[model samples]
Target: DNYNAINVDRTEQIPMDYTGVMGVPITFLHKYNPRQFEIVDGLNRYTVLDVAGLNDNAVKNHLHMTEIGGKSTYFRVLIKNRKVKK
Candidate 1:
């Protein structure tokens, strides 16, 4: 998931079919439900990424640091759905 596209403000729009790791805006925590989702450390940190099994190349391609107009962007919280609706 692209951090630029998904955020807490647009949580309702998130796709339900996706089951892989996703990076979302930190604001998502405000509406977070522990029974439905699991928070994982973002790929921004080396140790966390390593523990999560995300390689450097994967991080570079998907979760690399982002900048808009020369300004760094806010952090994204990595998450995955723990229980999906059938």
Candidate 2:
């Protein structure tokens, strides 16, 4: 299955059905409200590994990784919408 990506400039398009981790542009911080969203760290390789309870030495190359349609996407800030129904 393909992953859905919301354009950074079009945040209003965020879907209500997904309550899991979302990778959004870093600039999203400007419009971010702590009450509405929860930051789940960055979407870079290092951070991704950290979140997975892994370390740098465990991985040879740490390319900034976020993917859509199995292609690498630009750097993103990992987040979860707090306002979404749980």
Highest TM-score: give the candidate number.
Answer: 2
lDDT by residue (tens digit), candidate 2, 46-83:
46536644345335654335645556666677678788
Clashes in each model (backbone N, CA, C under 3 Å)? 0, 0
What TM-score do all the candidates reach, one by one?
0.56, 0.64
Estimate candidate 1's RMSD in Å.
5.3
Score each candidate by Cα lDDT: 0.57, 0.61
Per-residue lDDT for 8-51 in model 1, tens only? Answer: 32577555667776666677889889888888665343325454
lDDT score, candidate 1, position 34: 86
Q: Report the alpha-carbon TM-score of model 2 versus the true structure.
A: 0.64
Displacement of residue 85 (Cα, Å) in model 1 is 2.7
Point out where model 2 deviates above 4 Å: 1-9, 54-58, 61-64
Cα-based lDDT at residue 41, candidate 2: 67
